[model samples]
Target: MFLDRDGTMIDEVGYLDRREDVRWFPWTIDAVRLLNRAGYLVCVVTNQGGIGLGLFDEPFVHGLHAWLDATLHESGAVVDGWFLCPHHPRAVAAEMRGPCACRKPGRGMIDAACARWDIDLTRSWVVGDRDIDVMMAVAVGARGILVRTGHGERDLRKVDLSLPAGTPVVMDLMEATVLILAEGERRT
Candidate 1:
């Protein structure tokens, strides 16, 4: 599974830099556990433009992810991998500046994860609260699910017609997981 970090797994706090700011949404751990049990790899694909914009740094993002991993470990859940893009078109730092393929709406991060992990994109699912998440999935033949959390409700209003037809939209990750598991059973 390809999941979005902010909004999907964790509550959207806009540029979460501090560990204390990390807040897991209700049922997040349980939902992830469900995916883990269902044999999903649970890879996180996030676009952290705050790093490029100078709101935070890469170390802050890594530290926050580390904290999240430890917290999930306490619950016996595991995140197989984390893929982040810290670049923006108008970044302050030269290295972080310029449009990048790794950013969402681009397939760089997803492609990297697939190559590194040998993921089967056709059998994968992308869960997130943004249109870009759906776009990413569509680009790589993965199913896309939009959850109405974080910026989801707002993003829903702005979702263009580019998304694949019949893309599932759920209340949150927990509900999305249920749907995914059920669909998997039906397919088998």
Candidate 2:
């Protein structure tokens, strides 16, 4: 499964550059564990535009992800991979100073994950709280579920009409997990 990091899995903290600023939702670990136990290669694909804007660097993001994994490991929940797009159209950082395909709504991160793991897009799913997150899945024929946490509610007001009719909009990660698991069962 593909998950969005900020907002979708954890609290939306504007630009999380420090580990101390991390605030996970109550059910985040449990939901991730559920997916992990169910044989899903859970990957967190995020758009960390802060790196491009000089708010933070890539090392900080990696370290923070490592810290998160260690914390999540306590509950037997682990993210298989952490992928991010650290680019923006107007980036201050030279390296990040251009739009990249890795950004959400783009397929670079998804492609990177597939290259590293034996992922089948047709059977994959993306759970996030934004329209771009859902569209990420749609780009590859994977299922997209929008969770009503973080920016989900506000962004819900202007979802792309091009998305499939009745694209799932759930309460949170747990709800999305339940729906995904049920769908998996149905498929089998």
Candidate 3:
């Protein structure tokens, strides 16, 4: 399964740059544990524009991810990988200020994850809280579930009319996990 980091797994604190600010949602650990136990390769694909904006550096993001991994480990949940795009159109750093394929709505990060992990996009699922998250999944032939957290509810209101029909909308990751697990069982 592919997941969004901010808003989807952890509380969306705008441009989270501090490890002390990390806050997991009530259902995060359990939902991720369920995915791990179910044999799903859970990976995080996030757009960390803050790095480009000069609010934080890549090392900061890595540190925060390390903290996340350690915390999840304590609960017997493992994140297979983390893919982040630190580019933005108006970035403070020239190198990071261009259009990049790894950004959300782009397939670079997802494609890289697939290659590194041998993921089957056809059977994969993505859970996120924004339209771009779903768009990324669609770009790679995966199913998407949009959760109503952080920017989710607002993003839902602004979703393009062209979004795939029947894309599931749920209250949060917990609900999405339940739906995915149930579907997996049904398919089996």
- Which digits, one per residue and each the tens of the lDDT, describe model 3 over residues 66-167? 989999999888999999999988897788987889998898988988788788898899899998888888999999999999789988777463457899
List, residue by residue over 57-149, the lDDT tens digit for candidate 2: 889999899989999999899899999999977897666866678988998999999999989999999998888888899998898999989
Q: Model 1 over residues 42-160: C-alpha lDDT tens digits?
A: 98999999999998888988888887899999999999988899998889878898678899978888888878888888889999999899999988889999999998899878746
Runs in model 1 with CA error above 4 Å? Answer: 159-161
Query: Any residue pairs clashing in model 1, and if so which?
Result: none
Q: Tell me the lDDT of candidate 2.
A: 0.90
Q: Distance from true position, residue 165, model 1, in Å?
A: 1.2
Clashing pairs in 2: none
2 versus 3: better lDDT goes to: 3
Top candidate, metric TM-score: 3
lDDT of model 2 at position 132: 89
Per-candidate Cα lDDT values, in order, are 0.90, 0.90, 0.91
